[model samples]
Target: MTRVPAYFDAFLTAVAGGAEIDHVHLGHWDAPGAIGPARARAGFAQAQDRLSAALIAWLDLARGHLVLDVGCGFGGSLRTIRTCHPGVEVIGLNLDPRQLAVGFRRDRRRRNATWIAADACRLPFAGGMFDRLLCVEAAFHFASRRDFFAEAHRVLARDGVLVLSDIVLTRPPLPEEEVALLADGLEAAFGPWPDKWASLDAIGRDAEAAGFTLLVTDATANTEPSFHTIAPGRSDRPTSGDVLRELHRLGCLHYLYLRLDKR
Candidate 1:
């Protein structure tokens, strides 16, 4: 078994305790009906709707297909996918044992879904094992994007699709102070962001380098509504009271939804 990174283990532990993996997103962001302490349920409803929209936009899921959910947290997305596409076979994979435990505990009776504790960089399946791969909110933990992409490509069947959503730095920080601030924020939230996050252009280049044909890349900023609904007390700016602000300031977020076809 590949040794899990200490930071990732810590992140899983934190999330299991109701802490958001990203420091900026509120603990209650994933709550079903309301953002923290907010009386408005519409925001929560909209948040769920927007997430469903984003997931569908990214996945293009089909029936009777084998789909892998990489970095699936608590199996919520896996359960949702199975519910949405009843004919699809969905498997959730996570490197964090604690997170997987949570998923399994919550979904042990769901026959259409399976949870696997596995490393993204070195998947345990045979080559061409899956028809589609989906990753949300976890690609940044990969130490080597090239290796991660290569592994995904190796396990994917020819012409299989890969859909991923993650945080990307739009512009390189200009000053040393800015860079340090970003690093510190990341460390506080999870551990360390990957050393080589590319610009949007670079993301495409790297996909090509890993032998994938890029199909789509979109942002969630416009699609996702304000955090006010999900995390009522959250501020737009980083302050002690605003978790979302801290996440944004730390450069911990900026959505990138990408689709690629394996060659």
Candidate 2:
């Protein structure tokens, strides 16, 4: 097994409690019954549910379909998928053993969902093993998104679909200071990232080079709610939302919804 990164170990240590985050990703307020001011006021759990539902809708899952949730933090999306599509088989792959242990404990009742501690860069499965792949707000931390994409393409069947929601660079090169701030801010809040940020065009190129055809892209404005709903006394570290907001103001970043199919 590939060794886990030290900074990531530190991150898990910082947020050691189980189920502390109902959802770590910024949610889709455009989801049904979650739109407008009402969604903005909804609690963290509700917003996360909406976001999971929206991403799941893109998969078009079928009975007996095999799904892989890469970087499946705490298995929230895994549970959502398994509960919604009980006939589907779901696997959650994460680097943190603590997270996998906690997720397995929480998911014991859902026989269709399971968790594993594995690196995304080097998936330990056979080619054409999965029917669908989902990565929620966690691709940015991969050792190499390009490598992960290639692995996903290799492991997915010809008809498989890849759905990912993540923070992507939306504009031109960032100022050096801004880049440093973004990197430092993220390390302070969550953990280390290999490249920190990649441009949308670069990501698309990587996906195409990995043999995928980009099908859909949704750039959303519902970025601020996740920060707004931070529970009381969660952490004293600088808020990731503030850093992301600054990047957004500079036209340097965005949270994007991407759907791609193996070609």
Q: Which candidate comes out best when scored by lDDT?
A: 2
Output the worst ten-in-a-row residue range by lDDT, candidate 1: 20-29
What candidate 1 gets wrong by more than 4 Å, as runs, is 1-49, 171-174, 223-253
Candidate 1 vs. true structure, TM-score: 0.75
Cα RMSD (angstroms) for every candidate in the order listed: 5.5, 3.9
Please give, for residues 1-263, the per-residue lDDT of candidate 2 as tens digits: 44444544544655564325545666555443344444454655777788888889999999999999998877889988888898999999998787677677677686777788888888999999999999998888787889999999999998899999877764336677866766787666655566666777888899999999986555456554554544221357644456665656577667788898999
What are the TM-scores, per candidate, against the unseen true structure?
Answer: 0.75, 0.83
Report residue 55 deviation for candidate 2 (angstroms): 0.9
Error of 1 at 18 (Å): 9.3
How well does model 2 score by local distance difference test? 0.75
* lDDT for position 102 in model 1: 74
- The models' CA-based lDDT, in order, is 0.65, 0.75
| Per-residue lDDT over 123-207 for candidate 1, one digit per residue giving the tens place of the 0 to 100 score | 8899998888887767777776677888889899878888877666554445778657656655565544565346666777878
